[model samples]
Target: MTETARTRYFLLAILLIALAAAWPELSQPGLLNTRGGGDSPFLLQRLQQLETAVLDGHFPVRWMPDANYGYGYPFYNFYAPLSIYITFLFRLIGFSFVRSIHLSHLLGYFVAGWGMFLLARRWFAHGGAGNGWAGLLAAAAYTVAPFHLVNVYVRGDSLAEFWAMAFYPLVILAADGLFGGGRRGVALFGLAYAGLILSHNISALIFSPFLLLYLLLRMRFLTKKQENYPQACTEQSRSISQITQIGFFKSYKNLRNLCNLRIANPIFGFLLALALAAWFFVPALAEQSLAQLDAVTSGYFYYSNHFLGTADQPLIQSTFFVDYGVVDREAFRMGLVQTAVSAAGL
Candidate 1:
């Protein structure tokens, strides 16, 4: 197939996976059951609060009017703003808040699939995975990932996290492309990393170390010397010893080029990314003491009590934590299909 045709095919397949993953939201005809369950209700309320605050000329929206039973709180000061802002854009264009939420979910899934496809294809090209089908499989695996679906349909639909996940591959791809030689590479990496931070601060924090490790490995790949030694010296006029010495001399001379890893790419990219995301995180960290971190971390929501895979319970049953609350509990499993795929991989 032509290059354009191949691109189209990849995109079409990705689009189908995105649509399939978001089918539940697309199929519901009536208004969203905001009260159905999970954190969706809280997120919807936050969306409306954001709209109100924005309309009131609150650019950063630190204080929310209706938080804590009508006494306002600095909701936007700490919360990541990208997802709600995106859904609010649809609201500005005349879509209802409910409809906007649905649309955002669709858009999030599609973006996730697209990002994964691009990253997977690049990885395949670099000989990390098989080409063509590998990209599609990666995208599909991520889009319909078990915990992701459970988060969307069960855990109050953490739209921020969904959007954050969508941007992960894009950030990695941009960082990887930094070594491929282009003036725009660092700028693009900066933007992608900024998007990740703005989408979900926690996700950005969790993924940062992994990103740094990957970049270090990539730099190593660039600096590692090639090992194509002369098997049979053909030119007898130039003795084998002479040929070997010449080859060694040339390799030694070009050592600088081989080790030409742009160590500044990540530093510059990270500085730019920090500058871009400063609008949110600056006030977030600075003014965090005003907010009661104890309230957020204490009680049933204690950070230590809810770590995944940390519990000794069986994976299937351990999915359900905090069984004491009156709220309906949903146990999320990482699907049998994914397990089978993992087994096949092993």
Candidate 2:
């Protein structure tokens, strides 16, 4: 509402517009060609399979072997269905299936800008000590983060990663509210968890443990406070403390309390994300592919073998050629350098 605040938002708006304009080029059928790089073809194949399913009204599982993908390939059993369902909805709007898939990704990245704004506002609320400047700082920092540039330049990986990262802090906040005993807030917590899980399973997995750790610490604090209450009103407190302390005698006691507390909702959220592919949890759970894991691990080894082993190697050796086009290896190099400089600034 002040002049400085207006200036900050204005700059953010301009940066967002620039990001939006860059999307089409990054994902254009031919230009900036990273789509043919390792694991990329598999992602595109999965999307193409979804497009086919949307057209045929049938789900197909074996478009390609999972061994060609990254760490989260087993989760494709989950991702495929979600993508098909969404593509179908877009088709209903008269868009071609291929266009729909591309548009979905483009729009997903575009909306991420708004998510960045929300994150910044939330950070400002806490870190700014209620000052507007803090929020603006967060927004600008997020907008210019090297990761955002990578997400924008690389098309397929952008949507899910951006969505997951953008919504990650909100998931923490919602879970925080739920653990605080506001039942209605728990539903929002559930919604945020569900959304992120659906967007990207691996990203969700990486985030889930952190979410659980935070919740456990917060809940323990609450329990401690309750224990300090009058004895007549602390029946639950006594019972919970006894259960947690029971582990002093038996390791299983801790497991029993964990089951009772259902402290694993974060894990459940991780598993539930598999619903993007199947109706019941079991079917998706079963289809997770170990081959995908192998492929991902190999890719990492490939990258490390080339880069870390020899510093004087061609800077471009670490880069993969995706199809007929070339990635700007220098852009990546500069991006990392800039990122380090930016973090130091922070």
Give the per-residue lDDT digits (tens) of candidate 2, residues 195-300.
7766665677678788778877866876766632232123323334554465632554544454345443333333334443235235555655533445544764
Give the per-residue lDDT of model 1 (tens digit) for 319-343: 2332212233324444345556667
The TM-score of predicted model 2 comes to 0.58
Clashes of 1: 3
Give candidate 2's error at residue 319 in angstroms.
Answer: 15
Best by lDDT: 1
| Per-candidate alpha-carbon RMSD to the true structure | 9.9, 8.3
Task: State how far residue 37 of model 1 sits from its true place (Å).
Answer: 3.4
Model 2 bad stretches (over 4 Å): 1-32, 35-45, 59-89, 96-102, 126-133, 155-159, 216-281, 288-337, 344-346
Candidate 1 residue 30 C-alpha distance from true site, Å: 4.9
lDDT of 2 at 292: 47
Per-candidate TM equals 0.81, 0.58
